[model samples]
Target: MLNRLYFIFLLVPFLFLSCYDSNGDTEKSATLPIYQDTPYLQDYSVKYYFNSSVSPKKVFEDRNGVVQVLGKNGLYRTSAGQFLVDGTLIADNTYRPLKDKSLNGISLFQDQFVYVDDKAVLSNAWAGNLFLPHDLENANLLEPGSNFDFLISDGKELQFLSKDKAPWKGTVEDGNIIQIRYGHEANVFWILGKNSVSTFDASNNQIKTIKINNEATSFDVVGAKLYIGTQNGYFTVDSELNGKPSDLINKLPVPSITWIESIDEEIWFGSDEGAYRMDIDGDFNYYYGKRWLPGNKVVHISSGHEGRVHILTDNGLAQIHFDPMTLADKAAFYEKQVRDRHIRLGFNASLVDLKNGDVNSGRLDDSDNDGLWTSMYLASQVYRYKVTGNEEALKNCYESMEAMERLFTINDVPGFPSRSFERSGYIESLHDSDRWQHTDDPEWDWKSTTSSDEAIGHIFVYSVMAELLENDLRERAITLIDTLMGHIVKNDYYLVDFDGKPTTWGKWNPEYVNARPIMVGDRKINSSNIIAMLQTAYHFTQKEVYKEKAFDLMNNHGYFENLMRPMSEIGKAPEDADDWSKMLSEGWNHSDDEMYFLGYWGLYRYALNDTLKTKFKESIIDHWESERPEKDGAWNLLTAVCETQNFDLDEAAWYLREHPMDMRSWDVKNSHRKDLTFIEPNFRDQTTEEVLPPDERQVQRHNANMFRLDRTGGDGSEEYSAGDIWLLPYWLGRYLGVISEPRLNKE
Candidate 1:
């Protein structure tokens, strides 16, 4: 009985449900009409908002050439499109009154305008209506005490409004009104407040709020995205009433943002400090600060047709042309051009003498002859850049090298060697005293000869160059080196005098004995010459004999051990004790204090043992942390060491920070004019009007104040010696990773 009753109930329901189709066949498909939204394009000539302390906020626009504005004075319109306010009358062609003296915030919707000031109003030339309270200032459009103009669409047949008290507003078909938009295709509107943002949706008639913890200083909207500038940077929202907010990417750290706008999908934010621009996807690429912009503060941004952006700032107004392709191409070109120029200009060796020619001996001697050591060092740096894809500068380096090869001889024997002299042994420093010796003063003739000190530096420079040249040049260089070694052996550890006797002073000073091979007072074995010879050999041949020689010089009786004593232990007091001592310690006293030779000492140590490396590291660290005079001392010392040792990346960076090279301070001293000035180790000459041509020899006393990592001050102390700026690139390039390390064979 229960089963029969259950079957009857199920069958009755099935029969009633199946009777839907008149044809008695199971339904094929249900038909529902597709809904399509109508698109409305608003024609606006000019749109702007005004906020003033004396009046309420206003939204004004010129639509179809007619000017209208909604402000605290109420909804206003003119047939002639002219309005008067505060003694100023604005006029245009056609105008209609949208709101009387009761509206403030207004916006255009198709052919009509919606506003709420003293009242919630909607108007057009055909009709006008006012609803809700006449005083809606405190209504909650999105946040308390905030209101915004409503957004409308004809397809939606509704408007989305933001009010302080109601939060949202909408119309009903039954003639009833609600605080939200009633249709499905309603446009979204946003309400901005001092520290909060509220969004209203016309489709859903819903309101969503986001409170910015930081003060909302400025705001702007671009399509579906909303941007809000706060006290601490800026943030963006995806849509009107949904999704989380993201930061306005790469906002500069300024006190506050005063203005913002959307132009061609890019966001332009103006702060009290400067202006910045970012693309729609939040990529910050353009920034105009005090460096580029005339004013520190930006006032406003306006967008015109065809991707034009105009900005108004505190200083004035500016227009920038932004084309991605052009900017990128220009930047690439600039980088390549600068690199090529730097290489070419640095390697021109004609500026200095390292060749077998008499270039510096005649007219060149009248002008300050640039040095041998520096020119060669610069050539090396130029080559380094050339090998790294900068082919345009190679010609300059090759030409300079050609000139240098012609200036020097392969043997101590006087007179120039012919091309066949390539197989000759060793090279000698060419002492061209005749060029510098004063014709009017016989006493100066004997004083202008090449010093042993200068010869030592020349050897090191030649050796380094030989290592870098081609095979044919290397063979010639090897012959020169052999010839120099033979000369040294024949002189019995001393340079031979012009008369062939073991005189006190050979070419440099004929009056003093043992002076040609002397050291700082009371110190034994001034091994600067020996050290250079060994280091040069090591560099060219990588031979153990040279390394052993360098070690022997550095160990006990070398220049290093002699100059290592505490500052107080050496030198006598001059009339001006303080100034004299300072000068002496700084390597100004070439006779009694061996401080001037520290650069060579560092080079020798670097080429020899590990003990010197440890010393150099400790000295630099101490200098970096010390105070005043000691700091200066440490800085000078460490810079010299770093250049010679060729310390790797980390060490070089630290040294550079400790001792900043201030080139601007370089100047010349007056005292140098009366004496011979040595620009580099092997380059020295008397300072006549001709030697340092009157035009080139600037008399600014500040020149000698500058310091370089490698070059020491010249005797006259005017301008940098040839090697100062030239050798810098060689060491700096190595430290900066511009050159690859030469592969070396391990013992």
Candidate 2:
């Protein structure tokens, strides 16, 4: 009875197995792998350095010599070789020769020197302790005294640094001393702190105080006008110090003001983070961290001779020489530095095989390697750099692209007849008869179904290569495109698995039953890849097919819907389309929802569709008129959208003016566990485990935000991406024609 039961169980499985064709024969076979004969890798190197502890904090030059504040150490003289400590000269080779006491502040008047210590003890002398004066009222000083300057210590009860000494010497006032600054001329000065301003006339022996509620941080005198930098904001008072000062101007936001000085005619202010210069007309320019200063936390700023500005910071001293000829030259220099530091990597082009018959299941470059796709993206950036008149960048891009091209097969096939290229070092099969089946879990499975997207990347790359190369290579590109089209048409616009079955495209939840022609055989039609191909094809052939494809994809599919979803879902119009059901249902699972399909949104408005041009006008007004309550995700999204769409310049300008992406806590990091719940191990090497640190994850999000700020289109936003050759042309073509007010808010 047991043997009979076991036989029945085996017979039942055999009966089910015989239900389908036992031969496992299909109409089509898997395509043969097209291996590129010569595959090459590009070699490039970059070097970077960070400042040392002994780096100078502030640098200033006088007719007598160059002076620098050595942070905790006292002021050092650069004119003579040896270090001057007190009155004596130290050894020539001594790197740090000053005393260990914190020298918070320093100022030079002719040959005399005045400085405040960590204890807020104001001291002055002609030659280091000789003829020292210290009779002034010694009170407890504040902790952050680094930004303080020595106005005056009269060797008596009250010091007259900002206000006139004659009248205040005898009078008693209860107002708090928040900040002080000496006027351009003698005996005329201004003093301000919490909610009041005190002015005194020394020769006339007259004193006047104006009560104000705003918190004043620092003040500076430019001609007769008194510019006050306060915690609330910046305001300018008219020349007359007496009576209620009229013609007050307030426009600029108040960053933590540390010190203010006049450099030539420019009003330069030292802040807690960095330094900024404002024109007489109140246009402000900022230089921070690696830009003009050595460190972000600027302690003090002072003017030296001959167009040079000296800056003192918590870290070290820095000197910036400005030429009035081109005001933005300094910013341009730093931009170049940042661009040189980062390099991208990705593949540009691929070949499809169709001889063995299974079109959708055909191999990319006859294999599943991904390096080719990776190199192309990196090369794309390089290509942009080259075209944008960055000679060095162009060279790097060209070399990288050339190296990528060498890693392919240079032979003719049935579907792709011209020379075909595959990703470097990827092998298709080990067994002859079972080429699709792996005998040994092949090294870098280039023939895997996961490589289908990479194949599309190759097609896009060829479009770029077509423009870059000349003569025969260019002709080969056309053939490559034709072959790719044939393969796609035969495969029914879908990638195939190694078992000759159609594979699903996209990750997680994917849309699109049939892969759109615009996106080739990719799972879903995405704005990024579509725009890339459209731009490349348009630039290369100036073909109507490419333009039509871009237009059709833009309108038919929900590209616009996806792009405008964030701003619209917040209840801002016709553009919104009320499409939140899908998003809302997904909820936290949609962590990547806000990841920004920047390529799509940026390119759609950049493409500038005439059909929806009128709709854009209404959308712009609606977006501006609507109130934005939140300061986080929605505001950031709208800001980016407005910037890219060039919709409401006034609104975008208002946000930028009101909430400049604060760089104060720029280096701070937040946790990602609140968003992404999972951390996967690194796959390339099984030995190493990869976990996203809270800071690193936060930085990635912040970087995306910064990229928005830097790349967003509009005169008010930073023009960092304006010079980006690859992306800028598309931006200019779309928005430049739509003339609008450059300034956000009308004064």
List lDDT for all candidates, in order. 0.36, 0.37
Q: Taking the tens digit of each residue's C-alpha lDDT, what string does model 1 give over 200-299?
A: 5544666566655555666776666666776566777765546777854432435367777776667777776555566656534323331123344565
- Candidate 2 C-alpha lDDT tens digits along 1-747: 222233235334423322211122111112211111111111110101123344333344444444544433345543221100001112212234235445544455443344544343333333343222323343212111122223332212234332112212432153456555555354554666456666655545465766655566667777766777764446666656554544334433235666777777888877765666777786665554332344566666776544446666665455553322110121132223223322222222222332211122323333233333333333333333323333443444454445344333222123321112333343333212222322232332222333334434445445544644444545655555445434433454334444555444322112342223221212122343444344344545566665665555556654444333323343111233234323222222111222122222323243445544434434433433332221222222323333444334333223222221111112322221112233333211111122222112111221123211111111111111112211222211112222111222322
* lDDT measured at residue 370 in model 1 versus the true structure, 0 to 100: 26
Query: Which candidate comes out best when scored by TM-score?
Result: 2
Candidate 2, 333: how far from true, in Å?
A: 7.3
What TM-score fits each model?
A: 0.35, 0.49
Off by over 4 Å in 2: 1-60, 70-73, 76-105, 110-134, 137-151, 154-180, 184-216, 234-236, 245-257, 262-298, 304-311, 315-398, 406-461, 471-487, 495-747
Q: In model 1, which regions exceed 4 Å deviation?
A: 1-187, 204-215, 219-227, 231-252, 259-270, 275-295, 299-336, 339-391, 399-465, 471-606, 609-747
Predicted structure 2: clash tally: 36
lDDT of candidate 2 at residue 595, scale 0 to 100? 19
